[model samples]
Target: MTKNNLVFETLPLYNKQSLEELLKNRINQLGDFSFEDDKWYYSKKNDNPLRKEDFIVNFYQVPIQYKNELKYYALLSTGLPRVIRTKCNKISQFLKFIDKTYLELTIAEITRSHVNAYEYQLRLKNSATYVKQGYYAAIQDFFMKLTDFDDTPNTVPTKNINPFRYIKEKSKRKPIPKKVIRSWDRVMKDQDIPIPLEFRTFYWLIRSFPNRISELLSMRRDCLKSFYSEYLIQIPTTKQSGGFIQEEIKTIPVAYSGHGKYVINLIQQLQEQTEELLLKNNIEEDIRTDFLFIVQQWGFKNNGDKPSVRYYDQIFHLKKHKINALFKQLAEILDFRDDLNQLIIPTSHQFRHNAVTDRAYAVGYTMEQIRRLTGHKNEVMPKHYTHQLIEKHKEIHLGIENLRSSNVSPVEFRGKIMNLDERTTKQLSRDPRRYLTWEANGKKGVGICSDITGCNPKGTSVHFECYACDWFVPKLEYLKDYKAEYEYWMDVVDRTSGDTKRAAHFENAIRNVSYLERILKICKNGIEHFKEEKLQEQLDKFNTPPVWE
Candidate 1:
């Protein structure tokens, strides 16, 4: 065949759909292709030609040596169908580039300059930097595999000569802002606006649960599992691990606070609706298990049987672009605008970021705890979410330092104060001057006591609780420590929301700080400086809780 005819026959000319079908058919017919029991097998196909068209028909086919290498690499390497398809496309593109540019050049004869030229062409064709980088990496991986292939007969060793190894990949997406998240939540929950129930529930789950959009869409009726009184959803992870496409499960607990109830109710309702629909359609027992989320759409089919079912599959299952478009449409409908009045478009991944960040800061979850909730194997991603929290904590710490600069004299203590240490207690027992006279059990006894004893149970040891104890006195040196303690508690109160045990603890600490402040004011002013009622009123005003929402 002529060079032009060879190029037309060997090169991939079809669209994505046609290419996928062609490759699938080729792999199934010529290779050991088996997908039984939901498991894929390509072991025997590793050494076989992937397609007869290139091996038999095309004159300028991918050199048999490189073709076989690529076939084995594609089969042996584990990735999702989409990912594998992308890899095949990248390899085909690289091979075509070589065949067109240097017709006589063998795979071994290709060098860094030739690879660089291919990348340059890719850059011209694909405007996205990340896309260019991805294509380059895939091509590099192809060459690397050729070098590792020990059973190579006519292939060249190109593992050590990877040209695209130094190329950098830049992130084109940014994490969603907290303001947008709050606004989106508020708008979705607004009953007057009348948003779709499914969309509301979908976004609610994304906000409340740290789950990927895909995981949420893939949820089944049996996903929910009860543990004690709490509920957990077993999610099948879509990420790849090791060299094989091994499936993994991530269990996410159903939160009892915030909008957790709303999420649970929605999932339960969806599950029930799916079951009812299946029964009504008289679906077979084997095909009755349906995805949790569904919607009415044209051209919908069931179990490869007939185009009868209108709502068979999950609404957003594997439809990431559509899901993102829906979010944008929701934003438009809600009139979501940033401070500058520009349209605010939200992405599905943003919900994941918002969930992780909210848990890290507002919920006061530790990094490890956030990681567990987010299904992250390490602290890196959790840290990224908590970076803003860390900055806020630093500001709070600085505020504490500024608040602790007050100068005050130490309150005079008539009786020696005993430390909690055993040695100090022995010394207090030995010294009569350290004891305060008290009448107990019809006998005049020497013991620790003060005019005010309303703070704690009698005879109980006072430690850090001194801030709330009326008998305890403050000193100039300890004033800074008191301010620091007060500021820390206030910061915690500001970050925490809803009715949680930690929020309650922070409120209690704030109350103690108010008590300490009252005492300090009294010490600054002499006795009878102000009316008792007026002082009490002022203390009440100071202790009023600040509204967070």
Candidate 2:
């Protein structure tokens, strides 16, 4: 993969602007600040509403040769307040590294050798590839993006190749385990859990919508809408094209039930609280200040740990670190542990991975269709995650206690055979929505109903009869249920005797037993055919363990 090839982390937008034009623009204006000065105290930007530190860049902190180049990229790359601060901070580290390497060096004097040495030092100090790559990113952007202007030397040798690709390492980020998420969901919705609405609602949004924390954190107060019968959220495409090239709005339709519905009510409550606090403080909520996360603080201030004083307790911008702190508190309460039996620290992005992977499971979705759910710039990740999910099945902790259909995936089991793969299932089914939760057979999730309408006929023996239906998908976890039902049909067949009516009823019972046996065989075939470790682990997750164990 090329540098910034992941496309999720950063967008290279300054390719259209040469180094010369940006330098001129930097001296003219960046929002309200003219960056020609030595130091800047910038607190607000037009685009992003999230709370962040001042984007103060003291050019004198870096040697003169690199100062203007840093200024050019920072100004042109972003207007988002937090990102502007991040660019300044990450690029500053690179400049500091250069200062120690050579007593004095001009920007033009810097070559690939200097960059290679810097990268070597980063690798030596940090084992994580993404962490090291992050430090080099701004510098890479500086060299790769700058164009020569007379009186300005922009001839860094590292400019030729993509900085992101140069790192040549994959991101270690993977989906958080589904079991942990289910636990988190249970805790998040509890009324007595004492999780502040700000953190709970914030996390709920991440769980419901697959997006980066940055995008959700900057969510506007007016983000929600009632589109006819459905409710949609106007998520700011904050990370689109690296948060600068073009600003777009993505509409995510929220479910009418579950946490989806709860979040809408929560947002409304937060908005009202924000309005009340603003009125009490004699402040007006404007576009810049109207945000969902920023609300009246009750328990220690939302941004920090300090208790809120009566007059001072007003809506505050919930910082990114504050959310991190909140999750740690929740994790501690839940006593969430990994396979190693170690305490697991949860993160905001963990929810996004699970959300994306779950959406990708809909076999009817194309790579392009999945991108809409992922908010990804390219279709690459939608395809990448399918294989990644199968590879990382072990790292994912699924429940062995419950035989819920959520743990069973017939689509995956079918995909093992060439003729009955996910692609083939899509071709065979007329409906775009092929999978629906089946809650019959005296259980919440016994199996999957491919066509719920066709299978459930009035007054018919639809319970065990589903085994014979073309649309019904038998879950491996429900193997015990199948056996029990088969016994019931067999008992009925043996008991019945006498005339033609009784014989016909006995024949139907025998037919039911045959269907159940066929389903049992299909489940057995799946176990034998998919002996692969990944598929086995998934099958083992929900199967009822032996009674002795």
Candidate 3:
């Protein structure tokens, strides 16, 4: 089949406005478009920054086969110009590693092996785990676009398409333990650093408040509002989860606390500094938005003058690099442990996790409560790894029902606990060497890093297989170990079956307690509510609880 010329009138439906605009602006400077055997041609001096360096777009209107692939790359590059630029560069690097550029590549030409090679190259460059996965996944989507177009006659090889499935990256999230919080508190309170107090406050807010970094960076001054009986700051749609946006304003609510208060104080300090600095240079309306931060150039004597809000077009990327550099410098001065490097690296999303974890401890909030605060619609936590970790712990502590149940005295429970303790100790002693090296003191002193035995090479997950590993063995052992606790859980389960109050107690215990003692405390606290069943049965105390006579 002979390829048709891609003229102004013949462009695809999705290509309408952009092609129309480009054609109008360039028709005079450029000539008619034409197609030759297996190739396409168009000539126009480029003005779009992305195309400016290339000067000309060569190749036939991307073959119908490659059009969708192009659009997929285009969709993934959706943020700011800088974001697109960075993403494009990353894509281009993959293309080069594969030895094909936009014109030279076809959907069918891409393959899983090619992706694997690119991944290997990326690993050699020491690309971070996420970066490697992101770039390759993007490339896969680029190939996917080939399937979406209106004119394509055939599909890319299905087998070669989704390289990410073969090379999924493992979870990189490091759970911040209490000690990390202590270190952050110590440094922030030192008050002797050369860093501006405002910057320090920004750092504190992110660490304390459940906010994505981009949301924090894009915070406009007006988003601040009174919430939960105190003033709270809202972070609108940022780059990560697309902060809740209203009227073109992306935002999330941050309630008042030691951290939230610090954030508010820092905003006032920066606003004053920005206003004074701008006014000194004769900049106008320094008060347009209530943004807590704005981009300014670092000229010989840079003015704090606002760049027409258009500057915010590149806000996400610019702010990310800015914040990353800031923390990196701080990491240097504090002689911060290299171990914390992964945690401290500027990421807007991690702050949201920190808030969830910190609040889960402080307020004893359930996952659902924390989820509501973080704006997660479903029960998914800030990161999958975290959710999985919590689920693992939940399985251990909350698996009381799975144990065999029969009438057993508390003494039997105590005896079983002692026996289990002895068995675990004996097992550990048998493999003491396996546990010793993994227990070295970290910055947090005998840190959770001791659990690093669980760590694996991130990227390319291994499917969980019971047939391959006996994960169920421990669950079985628990059933045999604590017969009394198991019976108690069964009782709770039966009591709560038709009773909402009892069900809530079980859920509360799962969310709030990790240790056996803590579990008892939570259950005890809810005992009053559970005991009121008879009172509830007497009559509906709709208004006032008819004087507890």
Candidate 1, 38-123: lDDT as tens digits: 22334332312333222221112345435645565564444544455567667777887887888867665777677668867876
Q: Candidate 2 at 434: error in angstroms?
A: 45
Model 3 Cα lDDT, one tens digit per residue, 136-173: 66564444332323343233322343333345568987
Question: Where is model 3 more than 4 Å wrong at Cα?
Answer: 1-150, 154-165, 169-180, 190-195, 238-251, 254-259, 282-291, 295-318, 335-353, 359-549
lDDT of 3: 0.40
Q: Summarize candidate 2's per-residue lDDT along 1-549 as a digit string, tens digits.
A: 122221112212452244345355544444455656666545434333343244455666766767776776665554554565676777777778888888678665676778788877877784566666677776665654443223223344443343434445677885666666677778777776556667768877776556778778887889887744346677665443233333345455544444445777887777776667656764435434776676554433332432222234455677667677767755665577766777777778777766555432221223444465468877444446534422322121111111123224242243232224464354224222223334434565565555421222111133443454444566666677778877877776555422222433443454455556656766776666566656778888869687899
lDDT of each: 0.47, 0.54, 0.40
TM-score of 2: 0.46
Once superposed on the true structure, which residue ranges of model 1 sit more than 4 Å away at CA?
A: 1-61, 82-140, 143-150, 153-156, 159-169, 172-180, 190-196, 240-246, 255-258, 281-289, 297-318, 360-549
Q: Model 1, clash count?
A: 0
Pairs that collide, model 1:
none
Q: Candidate 1's error at 158, in angstroms?
A: 3.2
Give the TM-scores of the predictions, in the order they appear. 0.45, 0.46, 0.39
